[model samples]
Target: RTHLDPSDTLELRSAADARQQWIHYESLTRDLSLSLTEQLRLILAPTLATKMRGDFRTGKRLNIKRIIPYIASQYKRDKIWMRRSVPSKRSYQIMLAVDDSKSMGESGSGSLAFETLVMVSKSLSMLEVGQICVVGFGENVKVAHDFETPFGSDAGPKIFQNFGFEQSRTDVTKLVRESIELFRTARTKTSSSPADLWQMQLIISDGVCDSSEHEPIRRLLREALEERIMMVFVIVDDVRNKKKGESVMDLKEAKFVKDESTGVSKVKVERYLDTFPFQYYLIVSDVKELPGVLATLLRQWFAEVVESSN
Candidate 1:
């Protein structure tokens, strides 16, 4: 990890140094490209097919019976063609909100986060999955890339190189609000595409939210819940083995009840985030494990699409 100090700016090497570092990291993680490609090949197409219907304009494989009838009619003006059924693609717009605060640079978390970012960006770009938006946020937000351009083409290096430790605050609510606007913009532009557009946002943080912004953030979460946008918070940290076994991944909920003959009582439950359209995952310190963990979570996310489609 390269720690940059205020006085070190001029003393350090030039832009060439940063570019070389980026290139080196890319070369090192090159194997992940092939590995992610195979996983995507097995997951993307088939999963979409299970849920989406084929585009109507594209004809399916010729049905023998329909073909015979058309042939008997000497290819008459009768429209007797069966369009091939393909996956009715439900476009998933994924926005990755990465934390680039000073704290992230501690505990080796920055490197882990960057590694995960590269793996995911390259993987999704390779598969050409729905719109991929990567944003690095701390005090404010920095959009590293959007769906209009490929992930690692021109934006990837900038995202990695521009990550500084100055900005330290996290405004998650604002980020979500901005992401919603982004989705709305895309929706308007792609009105001709299928209506099955699913919105999913992944937040890479250290299980910390600005205390003062909690209420507003929860409100934004509720709004997201109503909009059916799946919010996934990926906490990049070490695991805590508590006797209660309650991890940060669990959502807190309160239940109220009254016994008609007796009295009223309140109950609290630590449950999975099924009641809301959101969930959280904990990523251990092992950076290499991130790719597999992400792949598994994405598979689960795609499974939700399948179930909803049915």
Candidate 2:
């Protein structure tokens, strides 16, 4: 279960506009026969369902949980189980590491990152499964929310409001290191089978890192791999257009860079792509496309896992 952070400013719309957006989001979820909890239904009730239908009319016809089985059978050609007995199934934890550095404030790009967070949170909520921990870091790291089941709108709103008060100051190295430490501690406290748990570390950032702390970041990745945590880095490229008219730049032009001889020698690039025991890297130029991108990646990831198990 995951709690989503609501937008700081309720994207209040005209009655007509609200009706339209509700219909759009609802139509997307309707086909699955996925019932939103009473709270979610109420929150979205003010808007007409018809409007939400059009946006997802042709959107990916995939549920978050289905991705694993689809990928397992298609890509890996392996038998994959869609549902496992709760006791036998591994607990899945998604540790989110968000960038809060000074650079993050440069282009008013935070809104895009915020939107990605919201979308991901919403998707996770719909799944109503897994343990999720949302962490924010800049100069320091803090756990914004932790959930063992899907959260309601009130809970989601609180998480988002807390995020609004959190400012960026921590470096990526510290953020990564702290997150790994937290996971380790949490693992020890929970008397669950480590093998049964599918741990994922998701880093969302603009791919910028503090050069001086290169070694620490490398070591952090190594430690995460040693613990059997699957690390995923989602590079949030700056959006091309914003209300502030921010210009988008190619990833190469951005801070992330690679050195042939040293292999990810630049701290930013190195931290961005540091190898892990089982890892995946995704670079997305637009936030709007993130949900689909994440779905694709998850499918590929689970396919590999299922194949290996077989």
Candidate 3:
């Protein structure tokens, strides 16, 4: 199902106007996030498999946690002596990386990126499904919110600040590598960090990858796949900015222009995303459709992971 932004567009002529728009959008996003999260919780509640140890009939391992409760109850051996530890299932871990290159800013892309990121991540967090890491990339990859860090008002504004259209390159390969490294580094810091959780990387990009960056990115993703890291790509196509009757697929063709000012070449995003080795992916022509698209993806993914664990 598609979701269209209900609020009318506000012209941003000054910093004050921009701030007002940001506040308005943030409020709307938070409300919608809560509503969506409630639905997600309902859908996923039955699938959650975390169960504490129970004291009942005798078992091989003693359940220390229930000993005090068992003594307090003063129940019979059959009712209170036996304690079994039901091993919990593995949890889902998510990495949300967004493209912050210049092309992504066109066609009011910034708002769409911001809206989609907040809506999906906030909803997932509320659902308490797993640990989540948010990263933004352009010239360099930046971690907007780490796994241990809480995603609140403070993290939201950092995305807005670093989302400038100044960067000319979208080095997604670096972004993924860095994200994986961060996860590894996190694991080293603690024995029980994101190492064992089912890792799913959901990358949000405009598909504006440069020509030289494609093969390396492809190879890196292939390596990631070999290591059992699930990849889901979300392509933000420039459909609204297209000329008359140009379909979304037309955005896959690359157009290159040299920047004489900086002696750098800028390339239009070549979104031959169908060839990419993503386990699951989708293209969104209209930014407004993003929240719904992501919600559906997440629901299906969470359901799949739960099934796999079971």
Q: Please identify model 1 stretches exceeding 4 Å from their true place.
A: 1-14, 46-84, 89-92, 191-196, 211-215, 238-278
lDDT of 3 at 48: 45
Candidate lDDT scores, in order, read 0.64, 0.56, 0.65
The clash numbers for all candidates, in the given order, read 8, 14, 3
Candidates 1 and 3: which is better by TM-score?
1
Residue 21 lDDT (model 1): 61
What is the Å distance of residue 227 in model 3 from its true position? 4.5
Off by over 4 Å in 3: 1-22, 42-93, 128-131, 190-196, 211-214, 226-228, 244-248, 252-271, 299-310
Each candidate structure's TM-score, on Cα atoms with residue i matched to residue i, is 0.67, 0.58, 0.66
- After superposition, the stretches of candidate 2 with alpha carbons farther than 4 Å from their true spots are 1-87, 147-150, 164-170, 242-279, 306-310
lDDT of 3: 0.65
lDDT tens digits by residue: candidate 3, 160-254 = 54456667888877886786677566445543434345666778876656556667767777777555566788876656666753444554666
- lDDT per residue for candidate 1 within 95-166, as digits (tens), equals 888888886765346665666666666766777657788888887888877756656565677666667645
Among all windows of 10 consecutive residues in model 3, the one with the lowest summed lDDT is: 6-15
* Poorest stretch of ten by lDDT in candidate 2: 49-58
